[model samples]
Target: MSLPADLCERTLNRILAAHPDLVEQETPLASLTSPMSPAPVGSVRVFKGSAVAKVVYVGLVVPMIQLDSHMIFAFTPEDSAVPHFTLDSVYGGAYHAFHLDLIPRADLASHLPYLDAAFHPLSPVFESAAGIEGLTPAAIGPRQRAIMSPWMLVNRASEEAFAAITEHVDAYAAHWSGLVDKGLPDDVLAGLADTDLAARDTAVRANIFSRDVDPVWAQVSRLLGDETTDAIRAELVANG
Candidate 1:
């Protein structure tokens, strides 16, 4: 059983390296622990960059770095037509799933630039990812399905499969960084706010981090202490 702790670090390091200018915001809950473990359960970081968006990362791993518990990266709105840059992966015991995607701010079908860059180029490989279960492409809606790309994988993984997952994650993180690197002009951002974008943004985020929809709420709370864990979730799903 190989520990993929470096995988989580690789993703975080990639984001920080890719955007040297991002501000690392201080958070009270930087680290959390698992109820039954010696090392921390996971760690979290928040970064504020240019007009593009704010980046948030939360990751969990075993002390040996052998068992990657969970790793998540979310890039949220503040600038131009962009979806949240999100990546979710988990490998522990016999549970394995790999999901890497840029969730469209709205509908994927109409978000042409995103569609052209993220989906069209990568979907074929992702769609056919080997040994991945539940790699279903369904119509996006207000549910968790809304934020997922058709290529997202949910299955038991193999060694070769894990390696493939790591490679895709690295590339996809770079892909999302490029999309939001320059960000949109301030004037452009202000113009888009006319639709009460703030309210919508908050709602969209809450939907993403809401405990009702959180898969690891219980696990995280037990590990980090309910209060601290909830605070982290609040930060991730914050409103305008």
Candidate 2:
């Protein structure tokens, strides 16, 4: 479906007005003819300078749409230089992780009116056949549900804190693997591998065990219960 032109203009104008730092220049459809020319039709480019003006695509725009229909935000030197405004936010959040496709630049203004009328306090619409309801933690399996609970809580705590926890998890896994490579005893390696089970076991005297882990697990446990946890734990134990 083609987005309304006036609404697109208004939304763009509003966003531009809200963030005065972004320099907005319209690249007329006729001006682009070469590789720079927007693929197919009904596509527009919003440029600050020599760097890629955001490429806005209205619905399927031919050869490119065969690859992906969603609009794309191509970053330029000017865009990179800015510290605060990231390509993600400008493009409507992280691309791959969230699978959030860029709203067509041409349709940004147009979509806003529909968004305002339909959705409450419209934000960036993530492109997914599985909508927010599908992505909700309750919809996932036990382990994933547990991890997501803590991640969401930590994310709410602070972005920096959340980043630190993620880094720690990565580092912890690497450190554990390195120990195994260095000929750590099988028992020790087994201990390292079973951190989650150890975390759950109240009788274990492991230093890594923390009460904090339970709250997150509890949320998942409440959803999936002990049976599922025990089943997963049995699989892990058998695999080990």
Minimal lDDT window, size 10, model 1 = 133-142
Best by lDDT: 1
> Which run of 10 residues does model 2 get worst, by summed lDDT?
82-91
Off by over 4 Å in 2: 1-14, 21-23, 26-40, 49-68, 72-98, 101-131, 135-240
**Candidate 1 lDDT, tens digit per residue, 126-228?**
6556545433332234456654565454454554566666767766676667666755445544445444445666666777677777566776776667888
Return the clash pairs for model 2, or none. Answer: 7-109, 7-110, 8-109, 8-110, 56-105
Model 2 Cα lDDT, one tens digit per residue, 72-189: 2322222111101111111112111111211111112333332232221112221222232222222223543232211121111122322223222233223322322343344433
Off by over 4 Å in 1: 1-3, 34-39, 62-67, 110-114, 128-143, 182-197
lDDT of 1: 0.61
CA error at residue 163 for candidate 2, angstroms: 28
Q: Backbone clash tally for model 2?
A: 5
Q: Cα deviation of 237 in candidate 2 (Å)? A: 49
Name the lDDT value of residue 42 in candidate 1. 69
